[model samples]
Target chain A: MNDSKFPPNTNRVAEHIVGLPKSGIRDFFELVNAMDDVISLGIGEPDFMTPWHIREASIYALENGHTSYTSNLGLLSLRKEICRYVKSNYAVEYDPVSECIVTVGVSEGLDLLLRAIINPGDEIIYHEPCYVSYAPGIQMAHGIPVVVPTYEKNDFALDPADLKKAITPKSKAILLNFPCNPTGATMPLDKLKEVAQIAIDNDILVIADEIYSELTYEGEHISIASLPGMRERTIFLHGFSKAYAMTGYRIAYACGPVDIIDAMMNIHQYSMLCAPINGQEAALEALRNGKTEMMRMKYEYRDRRNVITKRLNEMGLKCFKPVGAFYVFPNITSSGLSSNEFATRLLNEQNVAVVPGGAFGKCGEGFVRCAYAASIDNIVEAMDRIALFLKR
Target chain B: MKNNILRLLRKNARLSVENIAEQVSSDVATVQKIISELEDENVIRGYQAVIDESKLSELQVKAIIEVHIQPQRDGGFDNIARRLANFAEVNSLYLVSGGYDLQLEVQGESLQEVAGFVSSKLATIEGVTATATHFILKKYKEAGRLFEDGAEYERLKVSP
Candidate 1:
């Protein structure tokens, strides 16, 4: 009894868990949930339901009793499809047997990759105004997250100079999510190449989160993993959530060199065991037949983006015409309000909801992320309401 | 640009010139001009609501009438088709392929009136050789929109 590891009244949670800050948008959205008739543009996921055929495939699978766990690496058929998809789209090849592991989502894939490669105190350099989970994921894995601040002046693309400045001997990996969340910024080819070169020179591993690659609008999405000498140094993460509107299915995959993928899968096998079989079945159907619906949704988002961006700019919010993702990050400083103040007052006054840009990162302050993933009618109505609020 | 504007209008005819311009990535003046030109050219024939007539309290009988017509020597089926198109009961009329030369969607106040129109008016047309009429029972969907149950849904107020 006297050999107990800790005092009776000590805090039970791990130090890292205690250190993590709560989601920046949580309290603001909780207010949103209690409001009536709120037209929300705060959502990060697509408005489209998963297409019928893909859902039908999953139903077909479950009806036929295909509910058991898959191989830790995932069903062979699905892995083969993943390899094929990666090769055809990104111009990078991976062996299905040893170089791929299907995880719960790109979220899980990121977590697994971080856990597999990060040593205690190893630095993970990622850009700010990124997906909410990236920094926290690194920190959870006991890695120090080093932030590289990208600016609106460059359309939020990562400056290679910034990358070079952020790298250190302890910087184990650089996490890149182009056509990024929040800002909807994409890297031009030359800039992407420059960043790739910096990674190669620094001898840093790269984690490319490309879940939104299929949503790219202006031009082709270039994967850093496809660059010379990058195939061995990059872990490529892709998923069905954004592209297929299958966020609820929680299915994604990781592809990289054999040894690293094996390491991630080793952690995955003991923890997650495998991605749900029904999700794999749905993803299989998606890769086979989901292209038409996916493209249709992408074009819809593009149209919505055009209308929302124009409307926001018209109302005196300086909004960038983002060429990727379904968001328009409009600079709201003209309203003389901080991001949270603007979002809160807009919600309270107009019954229209948008995310405060500070929720993404400190660099995201003075802006607000308006998702164009709602119906054109709703978007138009929201824009009118926002205009009224701005006028007031 | 013309097709994109028309597609948006087709889905939602009430969209303002400003809204349409933004959606199609054009300007208001250009969108207004294109729409005016379209209307002048009859590329956009008319704008109307897609009503779910079944919701009305009054009786609304609709029939799909397939007509076999003897094509006129000079006018082909155009003469009879034009005549059929003029009838108030005919909601839509088209020159169809295969077993029928004409397809007519006719609406009337009652089944008797629809039957009377088909039998007395449609079948007695000089070139009409045969007619088959089928009455619509219930509509689960119309104009790409589901009717009745769950026609509208609201998504989560906020999400990550």
Candidate 2:
């Protein structure tokens, strides 16, 4: 029995696992890694280390032996802080005891939310060219992903008309990532209001992944859950990764109607158990004291964005100036090559690493996403090399 | 506007007016005009590159001298402080208010030169009384810049 399979078909893994493509940006980055003097604008994280005070808090917690898994709903103090944070900033309220569960990251929160709500063949309508995990999470939960394509001309904002068209009686939820990764598109109040209205009309549950909420540049982040009639129907997800430079800590939370959160906590209790208590302590410190550092990093990113925008446009790359996250989606159609070919060639020739837009989704083909979260000097140098590549 | 511009220039003097304007959310012409006004008013003083002399292959020694002097009939330590400030060897001089009447930071090519300056020039000044010279052993931080050098850190290559 161990030596011989009945046939290859008998030994095959599940069809869904076989069908799903590998998750994001791995191959191109592998080519980047085995190189000398490479400059990567590839990562979607803050270049700065986690702020000192937050790290210090985690260290203090660990020194006091707080290494155990927290309660499935997380430490009450952390949940309380999450409530105060969302209330003060977005005016969205969730009871610490009933309506919030701290998970591994926004990554894990996505998984828990999808698993909690989706039934077999339930449709999840989400925008294309989103963070790499959006579609995969829905698909893994046995939910069919319905793509709504957002264009650069629309500043990557989802059209409500398209949303209405995508919704059906089978549509179970709408997944959104704003100040979104890869695209860096933020929904303004007017546009966000329309999206919220569409969700209400369909009675669709909304999974708002707002991890990058604090990094918003131009204005305060406006949460759809904070909009009229949206609170009860939304599962608000956020994490300490982007804003607090705590990606390594891997703790985030999902807050919503108690029923949905209860379902999520059910899964959380079995599988993930709880987010790390040390990370929760660090995230709590960030919520309490990391504001000034966030502002400083925001200014750095904005400046780097300006430098990249100017330099890329100078080299004939059409960059959509993004006002939210640290990424810039530059149309590399001028290079007369697909974004994949462009990224491969640039990495090979100039030793500069950037993610091809196609890695995000098919709609992202002609563009390349450059994360300006790198140092200004490296950005300048990468631009110089890219300019040289463009010329050649 | 003026104070904001000064604050920015203080942090990074090499920043262009356009960069400062964007940071402060003002326009280029306004930032340029404000900077020009600051220059005229001497609020924006000179700019100098911070250099680590030890890294330049030059052997240098520094000494901080605390000199007590009886006040002149008219001028306090200001006269001697100004005199000490003019010396080419002096890096900085302050009319300090604590136990030390005056503080002088002096740099030289060797300890002998620094010792000679103190014994020959500083000791002969009229009304000069007690003197305590503290030789600096190492430079850790100077002018808000760190001097300790190490390997350039490379971040881990993979992240989402």
Candidate 3:
């Protein structure tokens, strides 16, 4: 049944889509899944279930006949709740009607934002050793991703100079994910002001992906848009996934200037149409009443962070204590093996799976991203296994 | 600082000092010292697990007895309260202000033991006037844990 008339490459995939590199992490996800006893310290989702109250609300919404696409901008009530939440917490205001659009997740929100704004070859500057989505997301939007590899010595804080160097006439926006993912770094207000000033001076847009805003351990996470003169140019990507432990709900939103959101919503209506109606209801419940459960989970993460950070350091892995997020990126240079080599051996020998830092970005070698979201007993046991592996 | 540690310990007595110190953001030594001082000062009276007796085959009976008592010239209800607390069967005693002067939570190996404790011991107190004992049929929630009508937490052992 071979169609011999057409050549193998007669019809080609889109150049941009074909050029997107396959994620190295997915291979490890599969490899770990095949093994019987492997401990997955590799996943980035929360170990906690979505709170009972949020689940109940979503169930009620379904029973009450909300099983349809919401408005293009999502339910008005949900947008209002999001606006109130940001205004109270970050002290930044947005007109919910004009400035907010509920997207499938930050995953979709980033895609929509990029397609809305980026012309061919428009450059987006982002911090490196970052979330795996940044580069591919930008590529899918037909934008060139300019990566600035932050140093571990600086605790992975974006150096204003490095960010400035990456900017040019072609640079359209700065994409930032603070309280960062793989590195577990957070940008304090002072550091954020420096970047904000640079963005203001350059007249470039700011794309702040503050999805982990609520999980900061030491101090409040400053939304870069909150700084003066920055609000007008900043597009905020935030959601209920990390904070409310609602990752599976696929609920997230974007808030920016009226013009930009309108542009994004134009694409959203044609593609995603609208976020799930029940997810919007659950998100509303999370914003209004999920504070206690959020704090409870945050408390658990903090304990895990402390134990893992201290244990890794004590074991001579030289981990920079992560003040935010649930991951601990520890330098494994002393092991004398490449990050992939170490991760593979650790899995094959000790049955503990950690994502190699190399999976994140080129500059991320000599380390591994160990998510501390597991129970304390597992974390302790994994650390013991790692220590034994190192010894062997 | 000490109060925060005590509060956390109240929620989970199984919490290690290392865990409590991490949450409160104090050094391990400082937390250890504070906890020891609290223990020496008798601020933390004791800790016990809240178990679901129904889950166990070795069943027990629980009863709450309300006692009306005349006030002593010296100790008021405190006198009867302390005397009631000394009994082996009394799990908890509170000087209540409603129709009763004292409320007792009593637990024993069987229904007969609880009944005997109420009739033979608790009623013999000099100031005791009348008694009403109520048997507990079930417990919905205790000390922040839900026994029934609660979802099991089935989070993946580890997730991203």
Candidate 4:
């Protein structure tokens, strides 16, 4: 008898491991991590810790023997809090019991949603220069990925005409991410309405990732799910990551139609019993009592964003002012260097690590994504180093 | 002078130095010198047939597709990228710099046909995460050819 417990050779394994060709952010982090006294501007996650109260709550939960798995949909209280949170903050209502499912993180929520909705050969519509996970997730689900390129002149906003052109009979869904990663651009209410109209007209489902809803600097973040007739068609993803600096907690939630939620939960149940019990407890505390902490972090991020934007522009880099999230995407094409070259050189020469724009997508070639989640001191030092590099 | 030479080349790539000089009303030496420089730089690699768009009514709709992807365990995006590159509808494939990972330039007869290619063909492939599609509204410029002459001047005049 063979004593080896070998994994099956399923073709599905090949399909699951997409998007490995280019992971510049991960590379940048590794490089930075390996360097001594490196001033890294590469990471997208917040530098702050989970709030004290939220941490305490998780500790309490663990101490009181709340370690077992909750419902497949997650703790009812957490789902209820998510419902209330979205409704109060963005005017979106979701049925706590039927419509919402707690996820390990927004990343996992995205994976589950794709697994639930995408069939082999289905097409998913998304904009270029978007978050990195969307395409690979679609591929893992055996779905086609379609990209609509957004122009930097438009601050990377989705254009309706462009969307209209991309639609085909094969399109099953669209993934919309606002307060977007890399760019930090947020869609206005009118734009959200337009996107909703497009989705309704085309009979397409939408997966709206609004994880950075609580971190908007210019105006309140709008939810596509809140639009008329959008609630049924939209799956809204949110989490305690950006707003509460709970990156390590890895807790997130998705709210959508009951059927979709159920499908996603089915996948979630088998794949990972539930989001970590501790993470769920911590997220609950975050939703309940971490509003002040959220605001404080948001303010800090906004301030840093402004500082970075001003400094980058002053140094002759063309940077669009990001109204949400904590990233500044500055066009470094004028430097006469490709994005990868600039990023690699910056990291190696100046000890400043920024993700090259090309790492995000082709449209990002001339740009560099510098996350401003670090402290002001780091930001200032990084900028100074960058200026020296540019001058040279 | 260069514009005239370019225009002549666009019409017929195989034109000789004397023939091009005659067409553009320039001396043979000047035209031949410019042609040599363009060739030396490899910008004018070699000219091929310029197919008439109207002749190929079979290819109608043109689109730019943005694809997001994740890495697979063993194969990664290489296999998927190669698969997409192999599609007949794909004119160009670019590994992009922004939100989406891959950019594909594709063509079809109708929007539905392109959609079919996406759904029935591209999406079904393993390792694809998400996709967004943008259709070409107007060809303002392509392959260094101006779509609408004087449009830029008109806009500039209207602005002030």
Say which candidate scores most in TM-score: 1
DockQ head-to-head 3 vs 4, winner: 3
Question: Which 10 consecutive residues of model 2 chain B have the lowest summed lDDT?
Answer: B150-159
RMSD in order of candidates: 3.4, 4.0, 3.3, 30.4
Docking class of predicted structure 3: acceptable
lDDT of 1 by residue, A31-148 (tens): 9988888888988899888999999999999999999999999999999998999999999999999999999999999999999999999999999887888888999999999999
lDDT of 1 at B40: 97
Which is better, 1 or 2, measured by TM-score? 1
- State the DockQ, from 0 to 1, for candidate 4: 0.01
**Candidate order (DockQ):** 1, 3, 2, 4
Q: Report interface Cα RMSD per prediction.
A: 1.0, 3.0, 3.5, 23.5
lDDT by residue (tens digit), candidate 4, B1-114: 676677557755766775556434467899889888888988687776634454454658888999988867877667778889998999889887888888999999899999
What are the runs in model 4 whose C-alpha is more than 4 Å off?
A1-29, B1-160
Model 4: per-residue Cα lDDT at residue A374: 87
Per-residue accuracy of model 4 over A1-392 as CA lDDT, tens digit each: 23356445535445347333456566555566667767767777888767789989999998999999899889999999989988899788889999999998999999999989988889999987877877888888888899888778889888877888889999999888888887888786777788889999999999999888788876677788888998889999989888999987999999999999999999999998799989999998888889888887876676567668877997999888888888889999888999888988987889888888776677878988888888766887888899999998
N/CA/C clash count, model 2: 0
Task: Quote the lDDT for A202 in model 2.
Answer: 85
- Docking quality tier of model 1: medium
Instruction: Give one digit per residue, the lDDT tens place, for model 2 in A1-392.
Output: 35564555663777776567786577677777767777889888888889889999999998999888778899999999999998898898889999999999988989999999999999999997888888888888888999998888888888888888999999999998898788889887888899999988889999999988887777788998999999999999998888888888998999999999999999989998888889999999998899998877777777677778877887899876787888888899999999989999998899898889988889999998899889877888899999999988
